[model samples]
Target: MTKPRPPLSKELQLRVFRRDKWVCRWCNRPVIFAPVMRLIESKVRNAGRVEPLSYYHTHWTRDGAPLLDELGAVIDHIEAHSTGGSSEEPNLATACCRCNVRKSAASMHEWAKRPQRKPIKGKYGEPQHWDGLSALFVVLAKRDRSGLTASEKDWLRVLAGATADAR
Candidate 1:
């Protein structure tokens, strides 16, 4: 059975968010800080209720611009507590609501290898690039592979490409 994760204090959440520069570590997307006062005013103006905000993932236009929406932020455990991971700062990172939900209880390396839908290019037919995922793969490929699983090793091999130094 998995142990219950320890509760994280608001102070600790703030610290981790700041440490990660208010950005989702996995997708490298900026966290949207919704202004509480503005929300309150909107609610008042809308008869004590406002249109529900989009707390889900963000969407980008074909031109590579964000859709001017808010993305909920979360602090994720890089290594899952179910797998004996800790709640220490080193194991914490800021993530968007989308990435956090998708990565629940999964290790970073495992989650990285999962296939993702390719984004569409702009009208001019510019190539769509996943710079964030590419950077993450490069970093993971360069890490020590002594304790990696077979699947992880295979992923590293593919990520590292033929030109990478022999392990």
Candidate 2:
């Protein structure tokens, strides 16, 4: 019998998110934290603020409908694993919940060829702000890793230097 594939390590998952800047490779939409809804729910419980902050509250549409929260980044195999793709970084990308679910097990080429929905626009045709908690989520989700690949370590060092320079 074929051995069951091991689950991806948490570190690897975070790395993929960082590498992709928490944007879906397919749709380029920012993936927001799913847990923020829980945070809002907790506030509702403690502060008793009921009207605006419902348990089902999420990013709202122009039409006043609630857009479902994306929760967190999902690692998608650019080449489906069922088609012999390995779990290495090269084969993986960060995907928003919607795109990932829609893509399913389709090959990347097939997915790319499909028609894409137009991105939502704001008043005056400005792009809607989709990165609600991206910076905060990135900071909270990443962990320092001792066993990072050489490139990963180098990228972190560069980021550290940039941060230091800003101060």
> For this target, which candidate reaches the highest TM-score against the unseen true structure?
2
Instruction: For candidate 1, give the lDDT of residue 59.
Output: 42
Q: Write the per-residue lDDT of candidate 1 for residues 1-167, one digit (tens) a residue.
A: 56777788656776676667666777766654322222323334556455554322224222222222323567788898887778988988887656776888887688879863232334664323422233353454455456454644554555455564735
Task: Report lDDT (CA) for all predictions.
Answer: 0.56, 0.58
Cα miss at 110, model 2 (Å)? 2.1
Give per-candidate clash totals: 0, 1
Per lDDT, the best of the predicted structures is 2
Which portions of model 1 miss their true places by more than 4 Å? 34-38, 41-70, 116-167
Across residues 91-144, which tens digit of lDDT does each residue of candidate 2 receive? 999887677777777787887888754443335643245443544323422342
Model 1: how far residue 20 lies from native, Å:
1.2
Candidate 2 stretches with Cα past 4 Å from truth are 1-5, 50-72, 119-167
